[model samples]
Structures are given as structure tokens and as C-alpha cells.
Target: MRVYPEQLGRHLTPLAQCYCLFGDDAWLIENARSQLLEAARQQGFEERISLEQDSGFNWNDLQNEWQALSLFASRRIIELTLPQAKPGADGSAMLTGLMAQPNPDLLLILRGPKLAAEQTNSKWFKTLDNAGVYVPCNTPEGQQYFRWLDGRITANRLMLDSDARQLLATLYEGNLLAAEQAVQLLALLAANRRVSAEELSQYFDDQSRFNVFQLSDALLGNQQQRVAHILAQLKAEGTALPIVLWAVFRELASLLQLKTAMVQRESLAPLWSKLRIWDKRKPLYEAALSRLSLPQIEAMLALSSTLELKLKQGGEEDWTLLTHLCLLFDASAHSALVDTRG
Candidate 1:
């Protein structure tokens, strides 16, 4: 009886007497609810009633609603939104009783938050589920996240190459509502054309208040606390993970290059100019180099590479990796973390 949001349409046919939609993602749950209502409407479910379960909600009111006849239309849909996702003793008995004696003219829909394992295994839930459809609307993550984005793009009649898709994904990885809005804007402005990665700038402005440059300065200066603070701020502001990764990766690579040349006793002036290390910023690099050896720089570079790989593979909590990579510049902080783990 369990159906995913993607497969709801296929199973919705023949129209089950009742449906239970529950999830952690409000957007997904709302979307599924709309789909179910539209299907009900098509099958002559002209009259609709909506109820939100609250502190004062009475199970008897629902029973009365189910028993009473609707004058506006013979076919009716009753939607009950459960904010608690918990139907206590009274509500449970009522639901099980109603399940045993379903009204031929009524289409019941119960929408609620995600349920715990114990709740799912309860007798009342199992009974209700046996009589109808149960759709879990959890948000997709990792590769599934990209698949959802791609589906949205196709449904909106827009074409996006791989780069453009990645760009769109980065812009709204955690903020699905905003991502949906952005896609709608794109559809209205320019649908049916292949969107390049570079063109995304026209529609969505940079929403991040803090830039990665600040992070770089903090890292090279070996300011561990400032690095952590800046990373947290960036994540809070919805800064793209890849943008942050590239900036840190760039710094790590540059440090490795400079550290290697210094170990080989190479000339500093030409190397500084070639690496685009400005005169004012030379002091920061020099100060960092004073304490770090070749091995440390190489190790940092390896860690940066691992971070990049994780980002591409869709690491959970990418901000943590970003924070770790940047803080590695401070040897004391890195050593403290190692000691603590020991």
C-alpha cells in the first residue's frame, strides 16, 4: 500500500477509498496532496471539506462529517491535516472504525508529518493502510536530489546541459522551495531552450552575503576561529557548496606549489608574480610558510582533493568538509583535533 511521490500517479488509478500522505518535507507532501485532490475531482468528487487537527479537535466532528450527507455535491472529499501526526486513542479507534465502514460517496485523505517506526507498526495504522494508500513524502538526497531537479526541468519544458544542471543544483540544494520558484521563473522567461551554465546568473542573484575570499584570507592567516565562523555564516546564507570548495581547493593547491618551490630553494620574486600573489598578500603566505613544512602542505593538498571528490559525489553535510579543509591551515587546531580523536 506504500507509494512514493513519483509512483503515486500510477497507483492512484481506480481511486482507492482513502489515502494517507505523511512526510518530513512539507513541499513534497503538499505536492502529493494536490495530485490526489485533482484525481478525486476528476472522479466527480465536486464537494470538498478541509480540517486541520489541533488541540481542540474532536474525533466526533469527523464522524459526524462522514455520516452527514453533502447537499452541494453527492461525491465529497474530506481532507484532515494532522500537524502532530499522532492520532491518540480516540482518533485511532475512530479511524479504524471508519476504515471498516467506509462511505461509498466519500474520499478520505489524511496528511501528516513523518511517523515513527512504532507508529507505523500500530494496529490502527496497519488497518487504515490495509484499506487505502500510504505515501511517504521524504525529500530526496544525493543522486536522487539531482534526479528530482532534472525531472522538474523537463516538466517545465526546459533543457539543461550537465553544467547547467549542476549549477541549478548548487543554487538550491537544501532550499527546494526556492529551487522550484527559480525553475518556474526560468520557464516563464525562457522555456524550450537549452540553458547554459553561464546563463543562470541572469535569473537568480547571488543570495550569499559573505564571499569565499574572506574564507581564504582567514585560512592563510591561520585564524581557526574566524575560519569556522565564516564557514557557518556561508552555510547559513545558502552559499553554494561547490563555490566554497573551489575557493579552498585553489588555496590549498597554491600553498602546495609555493611550499614545494621554497623547499627546492627556487627564486621567490618570479614565482610570486607567476602565482599572482600580490605584494600586500605576500606577508600572509610568508607567515604561513614559516611554520608549515613540505609534508604538511602535501597532506593538506591530499585532504583538499578528498573534499573535492566528496563534493562531486554529493557528500552529506558538505559544510563540515569545507570547515575541516579550511581549518587544516592552522596546525595547532589540526593537532588538537587529532589528539582529541586519539
Candidate 2:
């Protein structure tokens, strides 16, 4: 049976013999897996085995491990982490065969990225679905993202006013891990007190641990100095280049889409609604969009595409290229500021 991540907790009591937890979100996937493991332990699954499916991984090994008797515990939990989410013909057959006869003593957990629709409809997947639970862990965006943040704040026993929540939602937009850490930090520092937008600024300034989301915000908001400082910090901390590129690409794409829709004389309400762009963020996008022309946006998109390829090809100048792209925003914003001053 298929289940949502939130519903997994209740279903754990009458645990299925097998479960497939698949998604692209690392945070959600890890969180669900951790919960499942804890539930299995509570249900007397005392012995645990973990297998990472990678190059040279043998399907036969899974069978061997599954059939092997554990002297230490009567019940066992087997975790298979599939990075690619593709099980070859042989692996599929093995999995289906294993599920043919459900063993009450063995609990199987398969974790991986989001599977293609066709993959989900496969015979082996059907068998697993019939015999176990399938939970999706897709990353939440827009309102869903805000609800998640609200839950995190409540769970951490920290309170944030409307403005503070909006600020955080923008600051840590695509990075849930960072948002979680921020919530924890707030909980510790605020001691369950309600925090406002102005108060939160101090935490960010003092912490000096800006993430990709913050970098995107700074770039869009035309905070040149802040952007430069955050970029340097990210490089020093060895943040992955791909992550930074992803944030930049996402923002550029949004602006391009919005600009296109506006040019066509279409109502922005529908477009914003479809994009899941909340009221709080509408102003930010509008401000950035007003400053950026279609040609500039297109140029940036082209640059982003080239940078992505270069990064993939293991280019030595990847950092230099990324720095240059970031500074493009800085230069544009600086020019606008200078023009206004004159």
C-alpha cells in the first residue's frame, strides 16, 4: 500500500514485512528511515543489517543475508539503500521471489530516490506494494514548505512571529536542513520566547553561517557586500559548487517565467498560484524582476547552462566561473545604485 511520510508513524504499529521509501529529498528520506528503524526496534526487530546498492553490488548477497539466521535476535531488519533506484532484471526477480513468501521474522526496508512512474508500475514494485508499504518523500515547496517550517518551529518549542517566519522562509527557502538547524539554534537562544524579524537578523549576523538560499536572497535583494561575504564564506566552508548553481538556476528560471508571463499580458495571480509563490515572496521576485530585463535573464540562463556543463566535466576553473556569475548580480545592482545616486 502507498503511504505519505507523515502517515508512516501510525502504520508502523501493524508493520508490513517490507517497505519502499523513495524520494529525492535527503532530509525527508533520512528522517523517514530513522523513524522506521526506531519503530522496527520497538517492535522487537533487534538485529539490523544495512546494504548500500552500488557498483559491483551482488543481488545474491541480499538473498544470502536475508536467509541467514541471526543467532543474536529472532527478528531482523534489513535496510537496502539504492542510490540509483534501478534494480536490474536479476535483482527484481530476487526481490519478487523474496516477497512471494512473507517471512514474519524479516522486515525489509528499501530506500532510494523517486522512482519513475513506469518503474513504480513494474511487477516487482507491484509485488512489494501488495506485500508492504510505499512512502514518497518528495521535497515540499511553497505552502507545503511553510507548513513544514511551522511544524519544525513548534517541535523545537520555539515561536516566531509572522514577519520572522516570512524572513526565515525566504532565507532558508530550498534548504530544509539549514532551516531545521536555525530552528534549533533559535530554540536554544530564545528559550521558547517569540522572535521577531528584527531579532532574527542578529542571530544570522552573529552566526555568519549563510547557506545557498541566503546567497540567492542576497543576490536578488542586491545586497552586494552581503553577497560577497556569503560567497566567500561558502567557498571557505567547501560547500558544493552544484548546490550554489542549483539555487542560482532556480531563481533565474523563476524570474524568466514570470517575465514571460507578464509580457504576454497574462494575469500574474494564476502564474504565481501555479508556481506556489506565496504573498510574502511576491515582493522580492517583483523587485528583482523589475531590475532585470529579458536579455539579461536569458544571458544568465545561458551562462548557468554552460557553468553546469563545465562543473560536470570536472573543470578546474569551476570556482572562478561560479564567482564570476555571482558577481554579475553584484555588478548590475551596483550600477543601478550608482545610476540612482547620480
Candidate 3:
């Protein structure tokens, strides 16, 4: 009964009696909820009673609402929004009881933040999972994000060449909502016209300014100044710190894996293929691998973890930590070049 966000649409026509949509991505979760609501409406669910879980929320009220018949519609939709994803003992008991017997007259939709493994494995959650569909709404990363962006462009009926797509991906890195808006804007400005990278650049001057991918490339290419400048630009643009950390951590992780493989005298072709690394990016990985030793990569990863901890502890040194990480890559590349010339 578990489904991904993409697969929720197909299941909507043949609606389940209940559904649980949980994740950290607000935009995606809301969109999926909207889709479900639309599907419910089409399926003759005319009455919707929404309940937001506050401190004063009573579980008995939910039971009452479920049992009460709606005069307007035979089938009703009950939406329960749990902001914390924690249904206490009473709530859990109520949910379990409700799911014990299927209610064909009512559709129960539970929306909430991501549930921890323990929460998901609870008896109440297991009961719901067996009875209804569970849709995950986690934020996409890397190629996943790219595919999502491409889908959005296609959905908007916007034609974008490969370069244009890459540019758009870079422009809206770590911000899917912004990416969606940009696609809509492009669709409006370039109706029935193919948008080239040049055109996209001209139209989205501010958004196209910088991206974390570019920063990663600069780090690998030993462009210290460019990396610093991009970091500053990304910070000024309010790019999420975690997004930047993820990009750098990903590159470092890739380099570490490749370096370890090379040390083991393993052919990298099959490994890269297994990793699903594109041929175009293979050279970037190669360049970084050649420049960074395994020990250096490990040290960088440890520093990255420290940065994460600092952020978690509410430290204001995010930019400082990120800048240091970038400079570490640049320094390693420069050191490698110097060693080669020696």
C-alpha cells in the first residue's frame, strides 16, 4: 500500500479508503494532497471536514465526525493534519480502531511531517499502512532533482535544449518551488518557442547568477576565486546551507569511492557505470580523484560532518565552514599540480 509521490496519481482513480502523505518537502506534500483531493472530488467525495491537530485536539471528536452522516454527500473526506507527525497514545488508539474496520462511506487523509522509523514501525502505523496508501514526499537530489525539473518543463510544454535544461537546473538548485515558478515564467515568455541557454540566461539574469554545481566544478578545477565568489553569491541569494553541503559532500564521496577503487587496482569503468555517473562528468571525477588523496577526502568529510553538527547546534558560522571546505578542495588541487611539476 506504500506509494511514491509520482505513483499516487494512478491510485487516485480507484481511491483507497484512507491515505497517509508524510515528508519534509512542503511543496511536494501539498501538491500531492491537492491531487488526492481532486481525485476524491471526482470520485463523488463532496464533503470535506478538515481537522488540524493542535494541543487541544480531542480524539473523540474525530470518532464523532467519522460516524456522523453528512446530509450533503453520502461519501465524505476527513483530512487530519498532524504538524509534528506524532499521534499520541489516544490518537494512535483512535486511528488503529478506525482502520480496524474499513469505512467505505468516508475517506481518511492524514498529512504530516516525515515519520521516523520507530514511528512508522508502530502498531498504529502498521495498521494504517496495511489498510491505506502511504506516499513519501522527500526532496529530490542530484539526478532525481534533474528528472523532476525536466518533468516540470515538459508538463509546462516548454521546449528546452540540453544546455538550457542544465542552466535551469543550476539556476534553481536546491529550490524546486523556484524552479517550478521559473518554468511557468518561461512557458509564458516563450510560448511555443524553444528556449536556448542564451535566452534563458537573458531572461533569468538574477536566478542564473550562480549554482552549487558550478561551485563544485570550480573546486575541482582549482579555481579558488571563482569558488569563493560563487559561495558568496549563493549565500546572498538565500540558498539553503544544506544544499551546498550536499553538493560538496557528494563530490567528495564520489572521489573517495573512486580513489579507494583505484588503490585496489579495480577498473573504474564498471564502478562508474554502477554508480550511474555520466560520461561527461567522469572527467570531473577523474580530475578531482587525481588531485585529492584518500586521506584528504576523509579529512574533508570529517570537516563536513563538523559543519553539519555546528549548524545543528545553531551556529552562525555556516558560510565560514563552507568556505573553508571549498578552499580545502582548491588547496588540494593546487598541491597536486605543484607535485606534478616537481
Candidate 4:
């Protein structure tokens, strides 16, 4: 009876007696719950009693509501919102009791935060899972995220070249809600035609709340505290780790190429134009080359490649390690971070 948000089928012409929607992705969870409510309403669930489960919640009220006749509608939806997804002893027993008894007139919806494995295995959850539909709405990552994005794109009938797709992904990787909004905008602006990355700037602005481009400036300028501050803001604001990683890696690659060219005593002006490092940001790169040795840049590039690969391969992010990687741009902190393996 378990279903993902995508597979909800808009389920229930004849509504299910009970439903459990739980997940970390608030957007997905909310959408799923709305589907259930709409489906329930279509099938004659005209009255809904929403109860927020807080410390002040009384289990007795739930039973009384269920037992008491609904003056408004014969068929009713009793939704219990468990903020932490954990219904303690009294709530568990009440839920189990309700499940044990069949009430054709009453529909139960238990909405909660993400489910841990232990909660999934619990007897009460087991009974509910068996009796009703359970939807796990965890955020998609890696290829799953791309698939989700592709689905969105296809739904909107917008064509994006590979570079355009990657550009879109980089712009709104972690925040799917924002990504969807961006996709909607693209549908309105650039639908039915393939677009390249370079073409995206005519319409799309950087959607990252923490301003990912600023991270590049901070890193290359060797502003250690500013880099840390921006990084912390990105993390706190739930910016995807991959987006920040992409920015840092691009700067590191540019630095490597420029530093190599400098060592060869070649003309740097043409290379600067090719690399798109104009007058304003040229000094930052120059300063970076002065501070970091060629080997150091190469080493950081290698580590960054490894980190990005780990993410692509579905590995958990190590934020502390990423913070250390950004700090590597500061020659003063680089040695200590390298020694401590930060």
C-alpha cells in the first residue's frame, strides 16, 4: 500500500479509508496531501477536522470527535498532524484502536515529518501501512533529481539542450520548488525550442538565495572569513552543496590554466579573454596565482574532482570537508586544513 508522490495516481475515486503522508520534502508532502484531500472531497468527504499534534493535544478529543456524530457531513476526514512524526504511547494506542475498528463514515489522514526506519517497523505503523496508502516523499538526489527535472521539463513541453539542462540544474539543484518555478518561467519564455546555456542569461537570473557567484569572488580573492560566512549562509539557507562545489571547481580550473600559462611566460591577455576573466575579476585571479603554487592548484583540483564525483555517484555530502576546500584558497589556512584533513 506504499506509494510515492509521483505514483499517487491521484489515487482514490473511491477514497481509501486511511492515508499517511510523511517526508522531509515539504513541497512534495504538501502536494500529496492536497491530492488526497481533493480526492476525498470528490468522493463525498465534505467535512474535515484538522488536529495539530502538539504537547497540548488530548487523545481523548480524537476519540470523542470520531464517536460523536458529525452534524455537518456523514462522511468526514479526521486529519492528525504529527509534527515530529512520532505519536507517543497514548496516540499510538488510539491510532491502533481506530485501525482495528472499521468505520466506513470516517477517513483518517496522518500527516507527519519524515519517517525513520524504526518508525516504519513499528507495529502501529505496520498496521496503518497494511490498511492504507503510505507515501514517502523524500527529496530526490543525483540521477533521481535529474529525472524529476526532466519530467518537469517534458510536462511543460520546453526543450533544453544538455548545456542548458546542466545550467538549470546548477542554478536550482537542491531547491526543487524554485527549480519548478524556473521551469515554469522557461515554459512561458522559451517553450518548444532547444536553448543553450549561453542563451539562458537572456531570461533566467541566478536563483540561488545565497548568491552562488559571490562564493567565487570570496574564494579567488582569498577572503577567508567572507568565504566561510558565505558558505555558512549557503548551508543555512539550504543551498545545494553541488552548486557551491561547481562554482569553486570552475575558479580552481581557471586558476590552474592561468597559473600554468604564467609559468610558461606566455601572453596572458588572450587567455584572459578566452577564460572570460575581464578587468573587474582579473585582479582576483592574479592575486590567487600569486598566493598558490602550481602544484597546490593541481592538488585542490584533484580533491574537488573527487568530491564532485562522490556526489554524482550518490554519496552523502561532507560539508565540513567542503568548507575546508574553500579555505584552501587562503594560503594561511591551506597547510593546516591539509594536515588536519578537513
Each model's total of backbone clashes: 0, 0, 0, 0
Best by TM-score: 3
Q: Write the per-residue lDDT of candidate 2 for residues 1-342, one digit (tens) a residue.
A: 998877788888868989999987787888888998898888889999989888889999999988999989999999998888888798899999999868998999999998999989999899999999999888776578788888888888878899998888767755677777898889889984789999997777322356797787777877776677677778877888888899999988888899888878777888788878889778878888888777677777777887887776766437766666666664363343211111
Q: Which digits, one per residue and each the tens of the lDDT, describe model 4 over residues 205-304? A: 5554346787898788887865776787799778889888989899998998899999999889888989998898888899999999998888788778
Ranking under TM-score, best-scoring first? 3, 1, 2, 4
In model 1, what are the clashing residue pairs, if there are any?
Answer: none
Stretches off by above 4 angstroms in model 1 are: 205-342
Clashing pairs in 3: none
- The TM-score measured for candidate 2 stands at 0.64
Alpha-carbon shift of residue 310 in model 4 (angstroms): 28
Root-mean-square deviation per candidate: 15.0, 7.7, 7.4, 14.6
Lowest lDDT block of 10, candidate 3: 333-342
Ordered from best to worst lDDT, the candidate numbers read 3, 4, 2, 1
Task: Estimate the overall C-alpha local distance difference test score of candidate 4.
Answer: 0.83
What candidate 2 gets wrong by more than 4 Å, as runs, is 205-342
Looking at model 4, report the run of 10 residues with the lowest lDDT sum: 333-342
Residue-wise C-alpha lDDT for candidate 1, range 11-96, written one tens digit per residue: 76768879999887777888888898888888889999988889999999989889888999999999998898888899999999
Q: Each model's TM-score, in the order given?
A: 0.64, 0.64, 0.71, 0.63
